[model samples]
Target: MHKILVVSDTHRKDENFYRVIDIEKDVNLIIHCGDTEGSETQMQQLSTAPMRIVKGNNDFFSNLPDEQEFEVWPHRFFVTHGHRYLVNMGSTDIRREALVRGADVVIYGHTHKPVAAEIDGIYVFNPGSLSYPRQEGRKPSYLILTIDDEGELTYEIKYLELF
Candidate 1:
């Protein structure tokens, strides 16, 4: 089995964000959706594994890609920062891109709210913000996706309190 961690919108203020993640364990992949704030820089301080990332609207990652598309474990994923596609109102462009890329999952972060929806057999997920969260008046958050060697997949959006 593989455990994949997903985080976004860190905006960098929380020094404890890294503490909540046990990257040394059974984690097979890491995905960061952007706006890591200072967290991305701090995140860089510890190189755990190959990470997939995109630049958020407030993210300072100029070198990061505007859109990142990849396929893994027989599951294709498309990711973006969401601002360019106007994801807050729903992303038609991204949906199209996902179709074009033949993605089974579409991941993005920008609105700072956790969103999980499926459209036309395509699964779209937003891990929410690690430093900022909009729904349920809760603390920051992220997500965990699991895929077994047998090709079974499951995931959970984890809300984290990094105070």
Candidate 2:
């Protein structure tokens, strides 16, 4: 079995950043959606499994890739910062990319709002913002994905309510 923790749009605050660190022991991967800004350096300080980080529009780094595609647990996955794809335009932008990559899952960040949906056999997840969330009636959150040995995929949304 393999597990992954996905988060995005952390901005700069570190509060609750380590809320899901426990997954490091059981998960095979950690994925950061984007908008990390200075939080990238902080993430580097963490002790956990491997991580894949994409670059968001607000990210100041010049070296990070705008998007990334990879496979895990025999499943193809696509991740993007979402600026170039212009996700704000519509879901079509991301849906097209997912189709092109032939990925089973697509993850992106922008708009600082959380959403998860599946279309045409492809699953798309956005963990919203951890440091600065734009959505109402909730705290910052992230996504936890579990892929069992049988290839079944299960996902849960984890949020921080730390006051």
Candidate 3:
């Protein structure tokens, strides 16, 4: 099995970011959905997991791609920061884009809220914000996506306090 850690909108917070990385040390992959607030520089010091990062509206000087695609065995994931797709209004545009990219899953973040759903047969998820969470309970959160050797998928959102 492979463990993937997904996090977003860290907004320059270091303590929580470090804690999360430390806790998920066994993860095989790490995806940061932007708004890192300058924390990307410290990523080399954070964890040993392989990482993928996309640019967010707040990541002004970053050279990271605005979006990208990742293929893990039988699944293809479209990853983005969600700002350009107008996620605040709704995910229709984003969903359409992911479909066009032949993605089986879509991961994005921008609203500082966690989301998990299957729209039009594609899984769409957001890991929420590690620095600012706007959802119910206002807990800092992230996502753990586990993919077994046979390609079975299981994903769960985890709050910082509970991590």
Candidate 4:
């Protein structure tokens, strides 16, 4: 089984993001949807797992790609920061782009709202923001993706309990 951690929109304040890395120490892969605000290097150093990070709207000088596509065994994932796709309106545009890329799963972050749903046979997920959350209750959130040996996929959205 492979465990993947999905997070985004840290915007340079990484306290909660750091906490998540500590909590999910055994994750096999780390996916940062975007908005690291120039802290991608430091964040990458915190985990031994290979990481895939993209350039967010806030990362003007970053060299990361706008989007990335890769395979984790039986699943193909397309990762992006979502601003270019206008995701705040909805997932329609991004979903179409993902379909064109032949991705089985599309992951993005921009609205600072967590979403987990299967649309038209494709899995759509956003882990929200670790620094600034816009969802109700305003909890920092992330997503845990698990792929079992049988190639079945499961997703769970987790919120940080701030004290």
What are the lDDT figures for the candidates, one per model? 0.75, 0.80, 0.88, 0.94
Please report how far candidate 2 places residue 91 from its true position, in Å. 1.6
Q: In model 1, what are the clashing residue pairs, if there are any? A: 11-36, 11-37, 12-37, 12-38, 12-39
Q: Stretches of candidate 4 above 4 Å error?
A: none
lDDT of 4 by residue, 21-138 (tens): 8888779999999999899999888776989999999999999999999998799999999999989999999999999999989999999999999999999999999999999999
Candidate 1, superposed: residue stretches over 4 Å from native: 14-16, 38-41
After the best TM-score superposition of candidate 2, give how far the Cα of residue 14 lies from its true spot, in angstroms: 2.0
**Candidate 1 similarity to native, TM-score:** 0.87
All-Cα superposition RMSD per candidate: 2.2, 1.7, 1.6, 0.7
Best by lDDT: 4
Question: Which portions of model 3 miss their true places by more than 4 Å?
Answer: none
**Model 2 CA lDDT for position 69:** 92
Highest-TM-score candidate: 4
Better of 1 and 2 by lDDT: 2
Model 3 has how many clashing residue pairs? 0
Residues 1-163 of candidate 3 have per-residue lDDT tens digits of 8899999998887577788888875799999898886678688556668789999999999888999898987789999999999999888999999999999889999999999888888889999998889999999999999999999888999998844
As for lDDT, the candidate ahead, 1 or 3, is 3
